[model samples]
Target chain A: MTAEDKILPKPLVSVRGLRKFYPAGRRFPWLRSKPPILALDGFDMDIFPGKIHALIGPNGAGKTTLLKILWNLIQPDEGLIESNHLADDDTVLVSGEERGFYYRLNGWANLVFFGRLSGNSRQETLSRATQLAERLRLSGILNRRYQTYSSGERQKLAILRALLQAPRLMMIDDLAKGLDPQATRELTDILLELARDGMSILLATHRLDLAAQMCDTITLIHRGKNIATGSPQKLSQQVFPHRHYRIVLSGDEVTARKILAGSITSDIEIKDGHLSAELVVSDEEELAKLSLTLAQNGISIIELSSLEEELETVYNHLLQDSDSNDG
Target chain B: MAAFFIRDLQIWVSYRLSLFLDIVGLVGTALAFFLLGLAFEGYIPPMLEQYGGYFPFVIIGIAFFGFQSNGLYGLSGSLREEQLQGTLEPMLSSRITPLSLSLATNTFSFLRTLVRAVLFLVLGALVFSVDLSSMNIPSAIVVLALSLPPFLALGMLSGAFTLAFKRGDPVRLVYGGLSVLLSGLYFPYQLLPQPLQWLAHAFPLTHALSGLRAALLNGASFSEVSTQIIWLLGMGVVLLPLGIVALKLGHRKARRDGSYAQY
Candidate 1:
């Protein structure tokens, strides 16, 4: 492990055996009992300080439920959530719901009100709010009523309000819900910068691509149960044992296909002067052996590229596996 | 609390047309009562003879009823509004305690009601020549002060209903309607039938209005108005804890249902 990894602080928040259930449908006199919807069933997570931990799942996967539980906005039916800063002013939740702010008040007034409630002095709140507004590129519209802001701008202001608290742990739900591409990129950059500056973030989102790209750790949840937790690369590796490689050959495709057929057990397809092959190699050594074998067969490799396993594919594969297991 | 107050004030000020219309409505109501008072000048009830006019008696009733309605309705309405706007969860997530939140939600409405009470009194004295020179102002203030807690407790109860059920807080409507009909806001409770008078006594507003009118119109001292004060205080003592407990339970139920943020 790198020195930087070794010195990382302990978890700012740890959740264990967390369970929450909501009653399904309306109660009727004739009905004996209403079934409960399992929102979070034995969900576990450890969010380290200074790390951006992404809680990623599909809709109805309980990402927002978990966030609300952590924020203390909702109580879990059964769980042990240990957060170092749970009751401290240093923890803040930025919900994706658009109605948090007072619509009649301007962005600055809303920020100031929330900031003071979170324990900042009046002067300090104003100063921090100004700084955050400017950082989020929201200074230009801070004076406008919150109802007048576009969805993206409103979201930016929400993020700014959370930032104004200068929280030690910031819980963000669906951080990119209504943002434009540019704003999403800007928010991603801001989160990364905050993480670098030692802010622990619990980001709940369904945007797997962004989670893979930006999060230090990704926790995949399905049906309110944690499926896997690791770095994006590690998760990808866990899901996909075999790696796919696409090779463009300068020589004849027939010869390249023939050369790969003997060495690789997986299927090989030749298309448009390229040979696609899957190799179940555990390490680079095995891959190198495969490459040497192809070279020895008098085939020159023109351009070889490994088709990296993507977060989307891994997520789908995990969910499908879980489904089949349940079946 | 200050932050909440400032935020509410800013929002209230932003709706200038609503603010203006509110004042206009209050003035219009006073004007209607003035005309009615003139017609009934010769028919003043014996109970209201000490006050010298139906206008003074009714005006005091209206002012105190204003306080009760604003406290109870405002609390629940504000909570429901927050839930509909999706801000309840966020506000609850803040460092403020539940009781503090309850009080903070009513801050604007209570202040606005106080302003309207003053305006009503001024209009009554100036336009209708309702006498206030003989009012035991200190005793009246004490009675008003003592009357606040019970109404606040009722407000909290209504807020709890809104928190749990999202809509259809029966207490708000029942209390509002009953206070108007039985509590003698428009007339004296003596006019109601025997059994209904007993029912009226159950409401804190009945005692509060009686105490306010006694202190303000009849120049009653602390001892004279002490019975009503004692009843209001007793209700507050019993209901305050009940209200807090109910609100806490309702909050927990909402959280368990995962419907705290749902309107």
Candidate 2:
């Protein structure tokens, strides 16, 4: 593309060519004779303003490393990290485990302590904590010692501590780990509200369902590198190539195959002695056309379900591609 | 010593500046020690004759020993506590500057140690019939106040070592082993071997304790202890900046090694 034609939106945080390594072997790092193992090797991603960008990978895929670097808990060995919003008070990193707080202190005391650390007044932190805790359903527990909190409640308290800072960018690792469905929903809604209020969140999670539900863009990572980055639908298309639907029919599969023969990319499979067929549709237009053609025919659809939301399919496909490329 | 040094972890967790319990504990300790000194009052050695007896001299010795511990371990010990408690990364990432954090920790340690020393002296006078009515208060204050920077500088260096390696700081370990032996905490440095007495002069606490004994016990003026005061000021001038630089290097090294939260 010409320079004039190449229009790109600005990101709140931009990263490029990040690299980190840890010395291998059980000996001390400096004395270890083995070569270092790369944790983040030329990793790259961008976080747009007000968008939830997800980093999904297997264990040891360097999601935590990236978040730590962004939070300045650690620095990358090599990278260009550009962000004016990365000051100590302007950004925050919330770790998944709820172990960072002073357990002996009660929730309000802990909040006030961390708030002062983040450069906020005690009164301001208390006011903000009152509002945020109510939304998190943790208002009653503010007076209780942190060590007495339940596991999920402890995580919520940590989240509340982070939110009290009112950071411009928040990098949360494992957003849904150890959280129940109701708590996850509540957190998701609060996160959405915050994003709508113009806070950029870079979430690292292994939960594909959560990413698909809330992330505006999903960045699939593997082996310290970005394999793919796009909207969930776009990634699904990139990995899946087409949509698969399992159709249970009352009539014979022969009639359905005849109707969908030229429309579908893959062969219709009959399964379970029931007249059910799995067909791949190229796009929404073709899917609609197939449905209309089936209805026009004398066959009745017992059950029709789209497998587009099967994000596991996307992960497996992309990971296989990445592994193959590595090999 | 490692465990006792981190008693400041309570202050860290509470973030309370009052230290009321610490003072109460210090008073109890002072009273208990006064009883011990009363028992030993009859067996005063010839070297302790000028200082009035064993109680005043040894009381100055141990109380200041605790103060020196505050200066040496307060910075690193608190950091080690945060590291173990998993708050180091968050605290480091907060808006608090390293200068502010160091000053706050060292100030708390110094103030707490100062209060402990004063309580020991006050209790020695009121309850133990130890006369300090003729003591050079300004000289004692100057000696105590000037002694803090060198100790804090040493603490910062130890803190740097703790940050870089995460544990087993040689400054804390070696000094802990040697301070009570050579810095005249339990006995006079003149009692040590000639070579060890020469080595003891290198300890800032040795100068501080010696000056304190002369000022508090002998009522020596500041000019009389000018040699010790100059040594402390000079050491503070050199080591304080060196400590800051070392701490900065240690933090950078830890960041580069990606071990900020590995403890």
Candidate 3:
């Protein structure tokens, strides 16, 4: 067992046999009798305290639905959701929609209103909102009307509103949707700091790289069902059995290509200027054999490293597997 | 609730032009009534004679209608706006109870309508030469106070429809139209047919307006308008619980269907 798994805490929120179905085609008068679309089917997951849990999935995979149910914004058709700290003042959901704020009001006003609604005194709410706006680097735009702010600014304001209450459990859907790279990095650092301070977060996103970087555990769902749940490394190993390597050559580009060409032992791709090539071997022994082959052909390996299994690759593979199984 | 009021006030203030135009519209409405009253100066109905002229009767009608409209439509309109703006889900997720949310959402509109109604009355008495000497202020206050709950209940019912269904509330539309047409907003209910008058009595607005007119025009005391007040209170007794139940049921249905945030 890994050291990371040894000290895992008990789940703060436990959801079991969660199911939701939405009636389909009510908008079409001719298709009124269609069966409902099953959005969540026996979905089960546990969100531990003080950990960043990522709910990663494709579109229509029930991530948003689950978040909505957790936030008490929607009712599940059937489920048992037991949470230790689901109180209104301690739990918040930062939805992806940018329309949550009152456009006619400025960001500061909206934040103060949201903070007060979360059960803070007016003076305290204002102080906390100001502090949060400064932390998010949004103080400059805090007095501007919500409609006048850019999408990124609006997103930051939304996050600031949620953070004003210092919620214990925050369910964020697509948190980095409209943020620029710098803002995304800043928000990510802030989230990590919050988690370290014992705040539990359940983040739903299609940004697999971010999930892999920050999530302590990831629950991958497909078609309303959980396909896998584990540490990034464990899930990647399970999904990707082959060993992949990227080798940068110091010799002539054509020479490296000739050495790798028609190689039945591995799949190789010559990259830019043929100086670099990626090789996928079925096993560690096969990788060693390929490196030896390149050397025997006068190809000097300047740099060689095993490619870590990426969250995106694991996600795609699992999804394809599910698709084939359904088919 | 105070947060909701402050937030709504801030938003309303930001739309300065709309606020300015609202007062202009109220003035324009009073002006139309003034011209109409001048044209029918000598043709006052016998029922309106105690009021001294058609102007007082029409001004009171306009004022009461403004209040009634706010009661019947304010909450539903607020709910619709929140849903369209995608703020309803977050608001619902707050610690506030559904009943409190409903009341808070309508607070600003209610206060605004109250101010407009007072302005209408003041402008009528000052600029249009409507009389104020014989007005029974205490009884009129009682009538207005008694009229609130039933109309608020009706507003909640309409809000329930908006919550359950994203489209317009049919109950609000039909009730608002019938109240305007048959509740003596412009003329006395006696002008309607006997069957229509019976239909009008079913509405709390009919009793409310009858009581308000008696108090404000005929200088009627509490005892004189007790029957109308009793009827209005009875409507409140029945409709308040009904409306609360409907709103709860609609909230449940919306959550079930995942339609609470739908525009």
Report the C-alpha lDDT of model 1 over B203-223, residue by residue, as the tens digit.
989998898888877789999
Single out the weakest 10-residue window by summed lDDT for candidate 2 chain B: B1-10
Error of 3 at A90 (Å): 2.4
Candidate 1 chain A: worst 10 consecutive residues by lDDT?
A: A244-253
Ranking by lDDT: 3, 1, 2
Candidate 2 local lDDT, A1-327, one digit each (tens): 667336545778888999998755457646647888788989989888888888999999999989988888777889899985566677788888768887877888778777776767778888999999998889999899888998778778877888888788988898878889987887888889889999999899988999999999999889999999999988988977777787777666787778867655455556675566667887889878777877888777778777675778889889999999899
Candidate 2 or 1, higher lDDT: 1
B-chain TM-score for every candidate:
0.96, 0.87, 0.96
Cα lDDT tens digits for candidate 2, B1-263 = 21122334453546555456766777777677667767877865689888877778878887777778888888888788888888888888874555566666666567667767787888888877777877898998899888888888888899899888888899999977787789887778888899999999889999999999899888999899999999999989999899889888988888877787765
Candidate order by TM-score, decreasing, is: 1, 3, 2
What TM-score would each prediction reach against the true structure? 0.92, 0.88, 0.89
Q: Candidate 1 lDDT, tens digit per residue, A43-72?
A: 999999889999988899999899877777
- Evaluated against the true chain A, what TM-score does chain A of model 1 have? 0.84
* 1 versus 2: better DockQ goes to: 1
How close is each model in CA RMSD to the real structure? 3.1, 4.5, 4.2
Q: Give the poorly placed runs of model 2, Cα more than 4 Å off.
A: A1-8, A24-32, A84-88, A246-256, A262-277, A284-305, B1-43
- Pull out the clashing pairs in model 3: none
Give the deviation of candidate 1 from the true structure as CA RMSD.
3.1
lDDT of each: 0.83, 0.81, 0.84
Query: Which window of ten consecutive residues has the lowest lDDT sum in model 2 chain A?
Result: A1-10
For DockQ, the strongest prediction is 1
